[model samples]
Target: MTWPLQRLTAPDPATYSPRQQAIHDQIASGPRGGVRGPLAVWLHRPELAARAQDLGRYCRYDSSLDQRLSELAILVTGRVFGSEYEWQIHKGHALKAGLEPAIIEAIRCNRRPDFADVETEVVHDVAFAAHRTRDLDDALYARAREVLGEQRLVDLVGLLGYYTLISLTINIFRVPPLDGGAAELSDV
Candidate 1:
C-alpha cells in the first residue's frame, strides 16, 4: 500500500511554527539524518511528536539492551505483526548494528534466528515470548532475568512495546516506503 500523505519537503526550520521548528531542529540531529513521514505528520500534533521523539531517543540511545539485541527484538516484532514498513526501515539499522544478514532474513520469515551468543538469545526469547503470549511466561521470565538483569529486562520489554506501537501506527497509516525504495515484502 502507498502512504496516504504527500511526500514532505525537507523541513526548513525557518518555515516552521515555533513548536514545530524546535521539533524540526531535533529531527535534524536524530539518527536517520532527517525527520521522515511518520514524524512529519506528528509535527502537526506536538504532543504525539514529543512522545515519538522520546521513544526514538530512548530506543536508539538510552535503552539498556545493546543496539544489536534491541534491533533484533524490533525486527521480530515487525515480522510477527506483518508490518512491511517497520521491517524494511529497521532491517537496515539492524544490519548496520551488526545483526547477521542471515538472521535478519530468518526474522523476516518468522523463524527462530541464529544468534552469535547468549545476549542475542535473550533478545529472541523475550520477543518470541512477547509476540506469542502478549506477556512473558515463567520460563521465559526466568531466562530474561538471568541474562538481562531486572533493569535491562524491563527496558527490553519497554523497547518491544514502543516498537510495536510504531509498527501499528505505520501500518494503520499505510506510511509509504521511503521514496524510490522497493517494497520489503516484494523482495521477500
Candidate 2:
C-alpha cells in the first residue's frame, strides 16, 4: 500500500534550541533511549515535548498496570487510530512485555483475541470500549474497577489517553514506521 510521505521532520540535533536539546537529552537518556516518531515531531515545541514525554514516561514505564496489560491497551489505541507507526513500534514492545503473539495478531487483524485470563480480557475490553465509545458502561466500569482496582483503573485510563495522544500525533504528522515498513494495519 502507498503511504504518505512524512509531513514533518524533526530538527537536527545540532540545530536544537537549548530547551529542545535538554528535552532531547533527557528522553534519550531515559528508557526510551531516543526521541523519534511523534516525540521527534513534538520537538518543534520543546515544552510539549518535555511535558508529553514526562507523561509518556509515566504511562509507559511507571504505570500501575502490568507491562503486558499496558501494552495491550496501547495496541488497542494504535489499532483504533490506524496509526502504523504506533502499531509497528508497540508490536515489538507488546511481544517483549510477554503479550501473546496470537493476541497481537488478532488485534492487528481486527479480530477478537481469545484472552487466556480475565484480567487480560478486561484490559482488552476496556481499551476497546474506551476508544470506540469514549465511555464505559456500568457493567464494564464495575468489572474493570473490580479486576484492575482503583489505582490500576485510573492508570489504565491515563495510559489509554496518552496513547491516544500518541496516535493522533503520529497520524497527523504522517510519521512512518522505522525503515519505511509496509503498513501493518489495513481497513477492517
Candidate 3:
C-alpha cells in the first residue's frame, strides 16, 4: 500500500537496534504477539516504542473497561481521526466483541449509532465528546460516571487518550492498513 508520506520506514526485526530488538521481543511475546502499525513507526526511537508498547498493552488488554466498550472507543477514535488503518484494525475485533453491525456502521459513517443501551451510548458520548470538543459536558459526565462508575470512567479517559495517540501516530506516519486495504473513509 502506498502511504501519504514517504519519509518513514517500517522496522525490520533483523536490523533492529539492541533496544528495539528487546522491545520487539517483549511485544511479540505479549498479548499482541507481533509488532506492527504505530509500534513499527515508533520503533524508530526504541525508547519511545518500549514505553508506548507498555501503555498499549495495558490499554488494549488489561483495562477496566470490557472488550465491547474498549473496542467502541477505539472505533470511534478511528472515525473521528479518519484513521483508516485504525478502523480496519479494530472493526473486526469490535464485531467479535459483540458490537452490533448497525452501531459499528453508524460510527463508521460518522453518525450517532443506535446503541442497544444507555451504557454503550454513554461510552460513545464520552469518546465522541473527548474527540470533538476536547472535554465532556457536565450531563454526559454525570451520566458516564453514573452508568460506568468511577473506575470505568477513568478507564474511558485512558482509552480515549490512548486511541488519540494511536490515531495521531497512524495519521502522521501515514501507516497503511494491516491488510494493505484502500481508503475507507472520506470527509462527509
Candidate 4:
C-alpha cells in the first residue's frame, strides 16, 4: 500500500506489430502458457519480450535447480521485493512444488523460515544475504557451495539475479495479481 504505483494497461492485441505478435505468440504458447506479468509489459518491445521470456524459461524450467528450490528462491525474491503479484503467483507454486507451508509462511511474514532441509535453509540464507547485503559473505558462500554444489550454486545465483529483475519490473509497474487480491506483503 505504501508504494502503490500506477499500473499500465496491457496493449491491445490488435495494436501488436508482427514482431510483437510473434513474440506474444511465443510467450503465450510456450512453457509459461500465457503472456502475463513482465512479459506482458515487455511485449511493447518485441525483442525485449522475446529475450526476457527465453531467459525466464531457462530460469524457471531448464535450470539445474529442481522446481522446489526454484520456487523457494522465487518466493524469497517476491517477498524481499514486496511484490504482490510475484508473491501471489509463486506462493501456490511454491506450495505445489512441495515447499513446506511453514517455510512459506515465514517468508511471507518476512521472518527467517525454519527450514527442515538444509538446502532450503541455505537458499534462504544465501538469497537474504545477497539481497540485504548485496553480497554473500565467505562463510555463507562456502556453505552454499558445500550444500548446493557448484552447478546448482551457479543456478541459484542466476535465479536470484533474474528474479531481482522480475521483482523490480513487477514493483515498478505496480502489476496486480490477476485475481486482484489483497497485498501479501502488508506486514513486511
lDDT for every model? Answer: 0.78, 0.93, 0.87, 0.86
Q: Which tens-of-lDDT digit does each residue in 92-160 have in candidate 2?
A: 999999999999999999999998899999999999999999999999999999998999999999999
For model 4, the run of ten residues with the poorest summed lDDT? 1-10
Better of 3 and 4 by lDDT: 3
- Shift of residue 93 alpha carbon in model 3, Å: 0.4
| Alpha-carbon TM-score of each model against the true structure | 0.85, 0.97, 0.94, 0.95
Model 2: pairs clashing at backbone N, Cα or C within 3 Å = none
- The count of backbone overlaps in candidate 1 is 0
TM-score of 1: 0.85
Residue 98's lDDT within candidate 2 is 99
Question: Per-residue lDDT of 1-188 in model 3, one digit per residue for the tens?
Answer: 46566356667767888888888888788888688888888888888888888888888899899999999999999999999989998999999999999999899888898877988999999999999999988998999999999999998898889889989998887888876786667644
The number of the candidate with the highest lDDT is 2
Least accurate stretch of 10 residues (summed lDDT) in model 3?
Answer: 1-10
Query: Which candidate leads the pack in TM-score?
Result: 2
- Give the lDDT ranking, best first: 2, 3, 4, 1
Error of 3 at 144 (Å): 0.8
